[model samples]
Target: MSERPLNVGLIGGGGGAFIVQPHQRAIHFDGTRRVTVAALHPDPEVAQAEAAAWEYPLKGYDSYDDLIKQEAAKPLGERIDYALIVTPNHVHFDPAIKCVQAGIPVFCEKPLTLNIDEAKQLVDAVKEKNVPFAVSHTYLGHWTSRFARFIVKSGLLGDVRWVDSYYLQGWLAARTEDSGNAQAEWRVDPKKSGASLCGGDIGTHALMQLRYVTGLDVTRVQAHLETFVGGRSLDDHFTTYVELSNGGRGLVRASQIAIGHKNDLGIEINGTKGSLVWRQEFPEELTIRLPDQPDRTYFRGSVSANDGFLKDLPEELMAEPNIPPGHPEAFHDAFARLHRCFEQDVRAYNDGKPFECDGSKYANIDDGYMGMAFIQASVKSSQEGNVWVNMDC
Candidate 1:
């Protein structure tokens, strides 16, 4: 028999919130999941009004606490299969922990929590409870990312030597916080955005990309978190010199003050034999460079096998959800893929089956913890005159 669609609930994402838009669209993309309820805002009246005015009928709660409390009281089939925490950096830990304690799976936005201690607490709680938890590392959903992972980890690129993982943007080049931008305002505040703004906001994405594709951990880091725009408490530019577990080296950097760059998240890896490059803006294709050969470029749906460069591509990678080459899959598609993979785990958990929270398809709780740990280490490194800090703490 075909199973019914999973009901998902939203925490936060109301009143002109940006991230939630992509999330809700992605939730609805496959018809296997739908958002049926939400605690839309921090204020009761506003939340209620937003829900009432929502495009579709939805269950509304004044706050996330009320939503979790009530839904947790319902019968299994009548309640949300999972909760999506699209709240700010400071708000992630509470609702996520609540969902786990209440026996609900959670898919949360990144940078995990405000500090390493809270991230650790969340990790321990999830482990003790044995719940399904996914951290939204959105870019990992790209089919090319998986292919890159296979190529690098399979030693197709020889021994990894250096990687340059970075995400750059021009949005916060000026003090947009003073110009009435809510996203800019909260992100620039340390109390709301954590110790490092640029690092916590987007540098972690770069780090996740490096770790995911190369299959390595940043064991040690020396960082310089800088603030280019005047009067900002948090850094707008983030740079880190990292030592990977395999004795390789790399740089995981992010900047919001770079003019003319919009969401320029990309990675280039150089190994003993050759190099591979990928850019989010041009996500459909990846470039491979080697001596005595032309640069080999592969598109998502147009990969060829038996070529000397890509001898035998994984069938599973070839089989992952995809459209034609010219159709072009972008941000929403990546988000949908993550949700789709997460849906499988949630369904398995619901049916009392063992699910994979192994950080393979989508990021697991431990990946989220590592992100926070990296941020703290970067901040400490910067504060102590840019000395190296070990990630293990």
Candidate 2:
């Protein structure tokens, strides 16, 4: 690891923010990345309260530009190495471009920016600076998900035939958009949410997860996106038929108005010889079905069942010292593990040593651009009576 800690300046993490707590916890989970929240730019009162709650004592600013300037004035070694962008979709581009242009790396939230044009600009900025960047596609770090990738790579599945994935949530079932809920308000507004709500927000997660596991690029997409709630401008539910680059077929569906469904993101892959099923709700288990034998359940930390990736998980993340097998680890723990890997890479880069996990191994600027393209293609296809549109990125 590096001899010096990487001082991190957070752009938008305030009190009552849903993601601020998790971001702070994940950053400090590993001792290697000593993240000092040098500056926080939120509402003055909210920022002070959040700083107190997280015990961050460096400084607090209401102006994002002032924070950037203050951090830039520090000595070379003491300057911020990265800025975490966790603001709303509409607020993503400016801070991201500013940070990258200032020669600081960025760990941006999903969707990159509000629209394709903004995303393209950010992508160009990253390339121009040649600074390391990453997007938080945390599912790529799940033990079982990585194992699924291994299964496909091992050819155990034997020429994958199809993939089915879904991400459903019921949080916005009601007219929360009309009720002025800040998160839902911006999410349902076309100005802030962009073209397709369901596709832009969470459908990107499903697509990224599927591509990561199967190593298949989407060649084309035929989509039907809808807004069920009255007076809503953006789609609340979306379904798409996908053709993969390797001649495989797939289906993706995401809905926020699905009643009684809470964070139910699941994927099922079918191959010539066998099949695999995994659900985010029960993230620790992977169901496998073989041609001849009955179905088997593979747990995260199982000795008899786990593949190389699962067995190679950090010792502390294992299920237990001794048990029958097939114990479960929760989702937050998986997210923490992803953060740990990111921290290792940051430290390695600082120390001029080989990074543990390649930043490109996870999502990056290209993935963000692809996601924007997916959103645009889905919206266009939906508008054109579910016609197929090429997403050859």
**TM-scores of the candidates in the order shown:** 0.99, 0.89
For model 1, give the 10-residue run with minimal summed lDDT: 314-323
Q: What is the lDDT of every predicted structure here?
A: 0.93, 0.76
- Model 1, stretches more than 4 Å misplaced? none
Q: Write the per-residue lDDT of candidate 2 for residues 1-393, one digit (tens) a residue.
A: 446556677778663557756666677655545556534545666665666666645566656676677776776568777777887778788888988787777777888888888988888998876666778776766777776777776677788899998899988888987776788887888887788888888999899878878878888999999989888888999999999888999998899999999888889999887898998888778888887777878776664534532234444434422333355556555556666656556655556666533433467778888888889889999999999999835
- Write model 1 residue lDDT over 96-177, tens digit each, in one string: 9999999999999998999999999999999998899999999998888988999998888999999999999999999999
Q: Which residue pairs show backbone clashes in model 1?
A: none
Count steric clashes of candidate 1. Answer: 0
Top-TM-score candidate index? 1
